[model samples]
Target: MKNDTPKVFKSIFALFVVAIFMIGLFYAFVSMPKGWGVNVNNRVSRLYILKNVRTATRLLDSGKFFAKGMKPLRAEVPYKPIKFKKTANLEDGAANVVTSIVVDYRGFDTLGEVTVLFLAASGVMMLLFGKRVKPKRKKTEPSLIMYVGTRIAFAVIFLFGIYIFVHGHLTPGGGFPGGAVIASGILGLFLGRNGYTPNHAGLKVFESLSGIAFVIIGLIGLFSVKSFLANFLPTGIIGNLYSAGFISLIYIAIGMKVGSELAAVVDSMIGDTKEEWS
Candidate 1:
């Protein structure tokens, strides 16, 4: 005998909202200009690929566009082509062009990405904030073989994560992936045992220091070269391990920050532990 009017109204309202959203999305898709972001000949894209962003900027500011019919094309910038394992002392000397873009050309965007991740992790911790205590029912401890195997595996996984971030400038993997790999290892640790609690205090300290290090590195670049996150240090040969200047250092900071933050998030989600960040 109960009325279903309220339920019907809610369903209708939800459908109406969804329809409106879909309509908007469809309109946006149809309105987008053809070949919106796929233009490889765009000036920004060209500069990014050329690794001569600084020179390009100066040239453009002096009214010298690279294309025809733009201020007489001032003096042509004789940019040497990049060669792997042969190029040396180039600007942003990262062998991996993507690394150069992410950490050097678009570093501000990368910082924002890290900040967003930090905020998400902080939200999880805040929502799950409470004193840790054992649950009424205890989880069964892991088997001996599982525990031993996971322990050994965790070491290798952790080391591999470090290597990924450290050699980010020379490889496809970077701080984000490296941190994710390390977090996966931490997750394995959780599965490797029952009632395993990570060092909450140490994690907090480590996360804070990593973020601070990233900011300090950017500030040093700002003061030294009047550009935030500039490659102020010496960029060695492109293929060398010590190349890419501060890009390597920044990736290290980002890896540590993301790894610790994600580990903390995982710890918070696996609540009912006896650890406090004190």
Candidate 2:
């Protein structure tokens, strides 16, 4: 009877959990509010110093003669100059800046994404090769590029990955894309050799350094600068390599860390696992 009571309690608890989960799922999908339109009553100020728009009604049939492409009228707040250092002048002569921002200026997002990649690689390794048992090794060598020349070619390819990362602030590609390219080099290495794995320890080292660099930079804002991500860097002459203060340094670190971590993760997935049991 005591055992029966315990079983009954367990069943009740399970049912209660299921019911709560079902209700939560129901509310999450069915009753979530999406603010589609502007709410005048809930105005929030911005640190970018932009001003509220006094009038935003379309100039339809008005005397103002805008150009051909200005027909589409829109309401927006007044523009204001954000209190940040200029990034126009950099040593690397690159035109595109959005990519630089993602890979260098806003590198926190990249770090989170790289961590996700690491977790994914670890999960794959655990799923396929964890708790290993004795199994027959597949003895056949892969007939793909196993030549010495191929490895030499891949060395150049890996260098190209580094080039991409280093020039990330100057070009369109940043950490994520550059990392993928670097991972391709490691993939070539894995395909060309037996049991060759990417450097996981090196990846950890690079990742830690990049994270520390980002934290130190953010800390500088607390003491030297007012805003959290305010670019207090000195803007050197535009169009010069290394001209953008701090941003250039930030991007290079992000590129190296991202490339190393991603390459290591992919290599681990493909090369580290042993032969599966039949």
Candidate 3:
């Protein structure tokens, strides 16, 4: 006799996958896009606060202790700090203030950014890494309804994900947000159908290729300019998706890199094994 778990698990997964398709469809077709804006420009300035004392003679005269008490807060800043250098701006190539700042002035922050993406990918993969793998010949009884539905569902999901990342140049969603949407959709397939595994071979190709493209873009910058991610391409019109030139290209690569890796992880964790209900 065959195990009955695939029948039960398949129903659960089908519902889950359908739900993701609904959400992605709603976001892609119904929601309005928001305009791009940068964070507030923060600069250091001397702030003098005068407090009232009842008597002049009762005042504390120790400048050392007063400055010392607040020593930890002191930046020891230069007399003047330049807020704008005529180098890179969102107008220069990138649309995002955070990305421009992190990727340009402080590239170490971009390393941390990539590291965060890596962490998210790792956490997702880790969730199912410890589950028991199925025997090669284990019989599965997944429903045809769920299986066919998820196959179509994932196709919509993958396209929407690509749209999100591609339009990230002009709109609100970028690689991170887009990739997350894609992962959510991929997760649905895992939930809906047992034995219907995601295409790991294709996903691995996506991950590896996107990673190579990102590194090559950075290397291209290095070959020409002073830094690793220097802007060398023609700057298109400001605020246009295709206009930002290299910035748009870079974000798309990053989106592909992130979305594929995360999807692969989601696919892996959702196994075709039987789950015992409590």
- Which predicted model would earn the best TM-score? 1
TM-score of each: 0.83, 0.57, 0.57
Task: Per model, state how many residue pairs clash.
Answer: 0, 8, 3
- State the local distance difference test value for candidate 2: 0.58
RMSD per candidate (Å) reads 4.0, 11.3, 15.6
Ranking of models by lDDT: 1, 3, 2
Q: What are the per-residue Cα lDDT tens digits for candidate 3 across 1-278?
A: 47566777899999999999999988886555445342111221121101011111132343332454555332322222213322233324445544444344444465467767777877876654654566476466567888788779989988998898787655667777778888888787776765556677888788778767777877888898756877777655445555545666666777877777777766655554343432
lDDT score, candidate 1: 0.86
In model 3, which range of ten residues has the least summed lDDT? 47-56
TM-score of 3: 0.57
Off by over 4 Å in 1: 1-38, 66-79, 273-278
Q: Model 1: per-residue lDDT, tens digit, 131-215?
A: 8887565557679999999899999999999999999999889999999999999999999888788898999998999999999
lDDT of 2 by residue, 30-118 (tens): 65545765443333322111222222223333534253456433323234342223444332223345654453344567657656766
Per-residue lDDT value at 219 in model 2 = 67
lDDT of 3 at 175: 73
